[model samples]
Target: MSAKITLIAMQVCGVLFISNSAFGQATPQDASVNQGTSASQDAELEVLTVEGRALSLYQGNGAVFATRTNSDIDKIPQTVQIITQELIEDQAAYEISDLFRSMSGVSYLNYGIVKMRGFEQESQVFYDGIKGDPFRTFTIPQLFNIEQVQTLKGPSGAAYGAGEAGGAINYVTKKPTFEQENTAELRLGNKGFFSGSIESSGPVNEDSSQRYRVGVYSSTEDSYRNNVEEDNLILDLGYAWDFSNDSTLTVQYTHFDQLGERLRGVPIDENGNFLTDISWNSNEPDDEQDFQSDIFQVNLEHSFNDWLSSNSTVRYYDTEEVIKFHQARALVDNDDDGVYDEITRRYQDQTRIYQGIDLASYLVADLGEHTVVAGADYHFASEDEVFYYANGVNNGVSNLSLTNPSYDSDISAYNATLNRDRLTELDQIGVYIQDQWQATAKLNVLAGARLDYFSEDYIDNEDNADNTSYNDLGYSVRLGATYDLNAQIKPYTSFSTGLTPQTASDQEDSLDGELFDPEEAQQFEVGVRSYLLDNILNLNAAIYHIDRKNTISADEDGNTSAIGKVRSQGFEVDALMDITPRWVASINYTYTDVEADDISEDNTVYRILANNPYHQVGVWTRYEFPAISSSIAFGAEYVGERTDRTTSYDAPFTIQPYTIYDLSWQTAVQDWKLQLNIKNLFDKEFALAGFNEVSGAIVGERRRIYLQASYDF
Candidate 1:
C-alpha cells in the first residue's frame, strides 16, 4: 500500500473501535442465488454477494438478495434485470448515470434514459411497486440515497395502470434500520470529480421502536470538455414507527437539484454514417448554456398486519434546458448533397409538471397447506410537456450549401431555420388485484389481473399536428405454478400479460382500439431456486419466451404505427455463495433475442430501433480479511460484448466486451478512519450508448481515484 493508503487505513480502524460503544447494526436472497449455470445440487450451494448494485439489498440474513430479487427469474412473472449496490461500488460509479453503461440487457441514450428488451424505456419503473419515471422533466433518481434499482420488462399498463410501450426503471431508496447506523463517503477522480455525503439512521425513542434516517449528497464537477461543468445537490429524510406491535407506519422524503451544460450529440454525414471521430462542435466563446431541475417527493406506508398493508405518495418537479449543436456533418460536407439542404440546426426548450396519489392493500391467508394472497391498488396521475425550437437561420451568408463559399454566395438564403413547437399531456387511472394459492403441499398456483384507463393529447406546431388525443381501457392476466423439486429446491413456470396506450394505434392498419386491444404480451417461463448448505448458499435459473402484439413503433412512412408483432426470448441465471467465512461473491447473466416487424422495412428501419445488443453478462466478488475484518474489499466485474442491436432496420453495431477492476481498504486510528478507492483500474473503453438517429456511439470512461477521512461524533 502507498503511504497515503496506509495512513487512511490506520485512521479507519481508530474510528471503528471508537464508534462500537455507540451502537450496532443490517437482503433479498433468491435474486442473488439464481444466477449460477448449474444450481443442481445441495453440496454446491453458498450465499452470494450482490449489494447496493440495483434494487437488491443486504438483508439481516447476510444473504445478498442484492437485487431485492427473488429466487427464480420467473418469480416476478415478467422480464427483469438488476444491478446491485455492490456492483456499483465495485465499478466506482460516482454518478448513478454512469451505472447504466456497463449493465447488460439495458442501454442508455442522450444522458440518463435506459432502453431495455429491443425497446426504449417507456413505461416499466416502480418503487416498491409505485410509479417513478426519471424521464419526466421534473424527476431525477439520486444515486446517493438509492438502495437498488429494479427494472421490470415489457408493458406495465396492467399493473401500473398507464405505461410506456417500452419498459421502466425503479430506484429503491435506502430505508432506516433498527440499529443506529452512520456512513460517510468522498470520491475524486477523472474529469475533475469530487463528491461527499453523510448519512445516519437510528432510534428516536429509548425502546428503539421509532427510528429516523437522514442523508445529504453534493458534488461539483466538470464535463469531458474544458468549458463544460456539472454541480449537483441532494437531500433525503425518512422516519418509521414500529410501536412494537402489529401496526407500522413509514414516511420518506427526497429532493434533488442540478445545473450543467447541454451536450448535443455528434452529427452524421450525408450517408448518415459517423462523419467525425469524437469531436465537440465548438467549445467556443458565446456558445455556453446551462440546464437545471428541482425535484421533490414524499411517500407513506402503513401496515395493518403481517398479511395486510397500504401506501400513499405525493410529488412535485420543475426543469429547464438550453443546448447548442454544430452540424459537424454539414460543415464537413464538400459536395452539394441534398442531405445538407433541408436541415441545418435543431434547438428546443421544454417545461413539464407531474402529480399523483396511490392507494393499495394486500391480504395473505392460510387454509390447510394452502397460502393464498390477494391485493388491489388504484392510482391517479397527470403530466405535461412543452417544447419550442428555433431552426438554425441566423448564420447568414447562406447558400445553405456545404460546398465552399463560391461565386454563388451572392444569392441570399433563408436567414434562419423554421421556428416550431411541440407538447404532450396525459391523465391516467388504474386498478389491479392478484392472488397466489397453494393447492397441495407440493404445488402452488398464481393468478392476477389489472385494469387501467388513460387519456393523452399532443400538439406539435412544427408539423402542424394539433390536439391529437388518445384514450384506452387496458387489462392483463397472469398464471404460474411452483413445485418443490426436493428437500432444498423448487422449480416453477409462469405465463403473464401486459399492455400500453398510444395514439399511434389510430394510424395502425388494424386500428385496434381499446376494444380490440391496448397492446399485448404473453410470456412463458420456467426456473428453479434453492437454499442449501445451512442457508449459506443459494442458486436460481430460468428461461423465457415472449409473444407480443400491438407494439407501438414508428413505421417506414415516418408515421407512428403499432406493428402488432414483436418478440423477445431470453434466459438468465444468478448465484451467490458464502463459500467460506469472510469470502463472498455473486454473478448474473442474460441473453435476449429481439425480432421486430420494421427490421427490413425502408424508412422505418431507423425508426424501429434495431441497433441494441442481444447478450449481457455481469459478475462480481469480494473478500474481507477474517483476521482484521478491516483488511477490506477487493472486487471486479465485467459487461460482455453486444452482438445484436435493433437499430437502422437491424443494421448491427456489435460492441466488444470490457471488464472493470476496483479496490478499497479502511482502518481506524485513534479518533477516525480513512478510506481510498481506485476505479476502472485498466481504463477500459467500451460502448456506453448511442441513438439510431445517428451512426455514432457513446464511450465509457477511464481511470479515476479518490481518498477520504471520517470521524464519528
Candidate 2:
C-alpha cells in the first residue's frame, strides 16, 4: 500500500512540473476597452500595483557546512538541508523536535537522541559553529533567538574532527544588524501553556559602526501526562563592531534556566503491548529537575588584501543540572494473577557540571583558478558528576500496582546512599587544509584532509580506584568532483571518512581489559540537483552507502568487545516548488536499510540497532490569499514499521507504523499578525522508541493547539 501511494504522488508531482513550466512561458496582454472619452471629463482607471517578494523557502543561496567558507550549495557536493527563519515562523516551530517533522530521514528518540541516516546522532549539536553538549537532559533548546538550522548528512570528518557517523546539526543564532527593528509577541495554547517574548536590534553609534541586539523569552506550560509541568526563561544578547581598517569583531552571550518534571517511559505487558491505562509520568508530584547554562563567544575577521584574509573564533561554555526522581526497577507478578502485579521503585539524586572551551583560526588564499583554506582548532572539556541511590523494601518509596497506581506516597523512610562520584577530562587538537579547483567552466574538484590528536582521563573518587587515561591520533580525508550538465542541472559524487576516539571506561569490563581502538566510518555518495521553471522549483536525489567498524558489543557473560560492524545504505529525494504566485509546496521521501556483519563468532549483533524506520515521507503545502492578507498550510508525515529485540540476545519484535497530520493559519492587519497552529490533527497514538522488555517504551505526543499574536515596529 505504501509503494502504491508513493508512485501516485510521484506521478502527480511530474504533472505539476510540466503544467507549471508551460504556464511560465505564457505572455500577458492588455485590452483597450474605452477609446471614446471626453477630453474635459475623461474616465480614469486607477492602476494600483501589488508587488510580491520572491519566496525564499526553496532557495539555497549559500552554506558553510561542506567547507568553513560560505559557498553555493550546489558546489558543496554533499546533502545539506537548510531550515530558514521564514519556514520556522510559517510552521510555528518552538523546539528542535517540532522542526524534525518537516525533515526527511530524521526522527526524535529518548534523551536528546536523533536517528539520522540509520545511525544515532547524539552530542553533535553546534551553536555558531562551536560544538555544544550532546546529552542535554529534560528539555531541548528553544527557537526564540535562532536564525536558522542547518543539517549536513553523512560523515563530515574532513572539516569537523571527532564526530559521529550521522553528521552534524548547526544552529545559527540571530546576530546584531545595523537596522532599527523591534517585535513583541504573545502566545496561548491548550494544557495551560502561555508565553511572551520580545526582540530588539539597532545601531548603537552615529556611524553605524557599532550595533547591539537583545532577545528575551519566558514560558510556562503543562504536559499531557499527569504531574508534568515546565517553567523556562531565556536571554540572548549580541554586539558587533566594524573598524576603519575593514576589520570586524562580534561578541555574543546566551543564558538559559529551566525547571520541569521528568517523565519516564511507559510500561508494557507480557505480550510487548503498552499499558494504555497507566500515566506516562511514573514519579510523585514533588519530583523535580533543573537545568542552567551560560555561553559566550567571540569572532573576529581581518582582511590584509584581496588575496589574503584571516578569521578567528573563541568560545566558553558552562552548564549545571540537578535531578531527583523515582525510577522503575522491575515488573513482577506478586499477586500470582497471571499478569504483572507490582513495579519496584528506586530513589535517585544526581548532580552534574560541564565546562568547555574552543578556539579556531582560518586563513583563506586565492591563486588563479584554485582557492585554498587552511585552519586549526583546539578544544578542552571537563565533566563532574555525583550520584546517590537508595533501594530497599522499607524505603520511603512504595511499590506501584500495575492496575491501580497512586502518586501520594511519601518518602520519609528513604535513606540516601552515596554510590558514584566521578570526574572526566578531555582535550583535542586538529589541523586541516582544503582546496577548491575550477578546472573548467563546467567542472570542479574538491579535496581535503585533517589530522587530530585526542586524550581523555577518568577518576572515580568514591572507590579511590586507579585513574584511567587513553590517547590516540586519528586522520580523515575527503575527495569529490562536480559537473554541470546545463544551467539548470548538476551531478556530483563524494567519498569521505570519519573517526571517533574510544573512552577509558569502554574497556572496564572487557575480557582482557585492553583499551579499544577508535570507531571508524567510510561513505560513498552520488546525487543530482536541478532548478526548473526559471529557478522557482528545486529537486534533489541522492544514494549513499556507509560502513562503520569497531562498534562495542557485549556477550552473555557481561564482557564487552569492540569487534562488531554494521553497514547502512539509503536513498533520498526532496522537492520544493512554487506552484503559483500564491502557492508553495514541499515533498521528501527516504528509504534506509541497515545490516550487521558477523565479525566475531562469540558476539550476537542482530538486534543491536533498533527504532529506525525503513521508509519515511513528509509533504506540506501553503497558499496565500492576498486580498484578505491571510495564508493557510497543511502537512502530513508517515513512518514505516521497525523491529527490536526484547533483550540483547532475544528474538526481534515488530512495531507497527503510523501517520500524523498538522494544519496552520496566519493573517496580518497593519502592525498586528495573528496565527493558529494545530498539531496531530487525528490524535494518533504510537510508540516513538523502545528497548528491552523491562525498559519499556517512549510514547508519542497527542493533539495540541496554539494561538499567537504579534506586533512589529
Candidate 3:
C-alpha cells in the first residue's frame, strides 16, 4: 500500500476501535466466529484471492420483477438496468440521488424533476412494483431499506398503470429472512453530516414458520450552500408467516419524515457565470419545508401445482406536506442594456394532503414450452391542496440587488390571499395478459395487451364554477422477439405503446377553459446482448425511437391546445468486464436527441426542451488487495452542454459541459467494515441546469468527504 493509503487506514482503524468500544455488544454469531487465529486469517485471505470478483453485481444476470414475468433479464427484449445492493454499499450511498450519478439515460433537475430518456417523469417511482407517490414533487426515497433498484427504460404503461411517458423506477426492498442476522452502521462527514442505522431479522418462533425484520435510519446534514439543511427519519417493519409448504404471506409498513428548506437557484449572468458565490441564498432562515408519509402493504403467494402459481399485493399510502419559502419571480433590467441589475422574490405558503389505495394480482401458468401471465390492478386516490401567496403578481414581492443579496424580509404580519383551494379524486382499473413462447430452438416471442379505464373529478373548493369531471378508456400493447444466435450472443427487437392521464392541476392551467385529451406514446427499440471470453465480459447496446402526441401547449396569448408533439431518439451502450481476479469495471454511454413539433407557433416550450443534455457517459472501476483486506474504487461522469431559456423571446444562454470524479476505499476487519468516500474530489465549480428566466443556474455541490463504519453478525 502507498504511504498515503497506509496513513488513512491507520486513522480509520483508530476511529473504528473507538466506535466499537461505545456501540459494540456480544452476539451469538460473533461469539462462534473467531478471526484472530492464523488459520482463520489464512482461510479469509485464500477465499478473497481465489474467488473475490462479483459478476452478478455488475453484469445484471438475474430476473427482473418489473416485467411481471418469469423470464431472465438477458432473454427480455427491453432495456433494463439493475443496480445491486453490493454496489450501493461499495459507494456508501445515502439517497436515491446519489445512485443516479452513475445511471445512463437519466438526468436530475431542480424541484424533484427527473428526466428519463429525454422526457420529464413524476410519480413514476415504484416500491416493489407498487406506486410510491401520487404526484412526487419535492421528496425522494432514502436508501436504508432498499435491496436493489431496477430502471425500465421507456414507457411501461402496459404492465404498470397510468404514468409519465419516460420510464419507471422500481425499488426492491429488503425482506424478512429466516436466518438470524443483525447489523449497525454509523457515518460521519464534513459539512455537519451524521447518520445512524440498525437492522435485525430472524425467526420469530422456534418452529421457524414465522419471521420478522425491523430497521430504523436517521440522518441530519448541512450543505455547502447557504441556508440549506435537512433532517430525515425512516422506519421499516416487516413480518412473514408460512401457512404451509405451498403458501406464504407477508406484511410491511414504512414511516418516513423529512424537514428542510426549499431553495432556488443562484442568479447567473447571460453567459451562465455565477453573479455571486455559490453559497449565496435567496431565502430566509425561517423558511421551512416539511413532508411525512405512511405506507402499509400486504402480499400473498400460493402455488396450486407445479404448473400454476399466483401472487397478490395490496397497499395503502398517505402523505402530508407544508412548504413556505421566498420564490424567485423574475430578473429586472432597469437600464434595458441587455444586463440584469435586480431580482424579484415572492412569498409562497402551501399545504397538501394525499391518500391512495392500490390492489394488484397476477397468475403465472407454465405449459410445456410457453409461460403465460395475466394480471389486474385497481387504484384510487384523493388529494386536497391549498395555496397562500402575498399577492397574485410580482407586486407582492420586493427587489434585491443582483450582486448584493439580503434575507431580512419578514411576512409574518403581512396579509396573504388565497390563490387556490382545490380537491381532486382519481379512480383507475386495468387488466393485462402476456405470453412468452419458445417458438423454436433459437427464437423466443413475447406479446401482451392491456385495457385501462380511468375517471377523474376536480372540485374547486373556493369557486364552485370551476368544478369539472372527466373519464376515458385507454388501450396499450407490446410485442417483442429475441433470437439466440449462439451460446454467447442474443439479438432482440420490441414495440410498445403507452398513455398518461392529465392531472387536475395541469388541466386547470388551460386559459381557454377547456380540458384536453390524454397524452399517447409509441416506441420501437432494437438491441443485442453478448457474453464473451468464457463469461468474463458482458456487453449490451440498443437504439430506440419514441413519439408522443396530445401534449398541452400554450400560445403567446395564453390560449392552450392539446396539439403539441414530441420525438425522442437515442442510442445506449453498457459494458462490464473482469480484467483480473481482483479487478472489475463498468462503462456506460448515452446519446439522446429530442425535439418538439406541432406546438404553438409563438411558444417557447420547444426551446425549453434544450435543457436536456444530448450526450452522457459514466465509468466505474474497482481493484482489491487481498493482503490488506481492502479495495479502492474510482468513478467519473460527463454531461454534454445544454441550453437555458424561459420564453420564446428571451435570449437563451449555454450551460457549459463538465465532468466530476469520485473515489472510495473499503476495508474489513473481523465483523466490522469501514468505508471512506471523497465526492467531487477536485471541487469542480459548475451548475446543474437553469430553472427559469431569472432564477439563474442550480449550482453543484463542492467537494465532500465522509466515512462509514458497519458491523454485521
Better of 1 and 2 by TM-score: 2
Question: What tens-digit string does per-residue lDDT give for candidate 3 at 467-532?
Answer: 878788898888888888875798989998889987666777776667778889888999998877
Among all windows of 10 consecutive residues in model 3, the one with the lowest summed lDDT is 30-39
Q: Could you give candidate 2's per-residue lDDT for residues 176-240 as a string of tens digits?
A: 87676666677888987777776767687877799888887777777777677787777889999
The local distance difference test score of model 1 is 0.53
Residues 545-613, model 1: lDDT tens digits: 766676545444544455547677776666666756555656666676766663335434343343345
**Alpha carbon deviation, residue 694, candidate 2 (Å):** 3.6
| Candidate 2 global CA lDDT score | 0.76
In angstroms, give how far residue 631 of model 3 lies from its true place.
0.3
For candidate 3, what is the TM-score?
0.90
lDDT, model 1, position 260 = 56
| Model 3 spans with C-alpha error above 4 angstroms | 1-54, 333-341, 391-398, 504-515, 555-559, 601-608, 645-651
In TM-score terms, candidate 1 sits at: 0.76
TM-score-better candidate, 2 vs 3: 3
lDDT of 3: 0.78
- Say which prediction, candidate 1 or candidate 2, comes out ahead on lDDT: 2
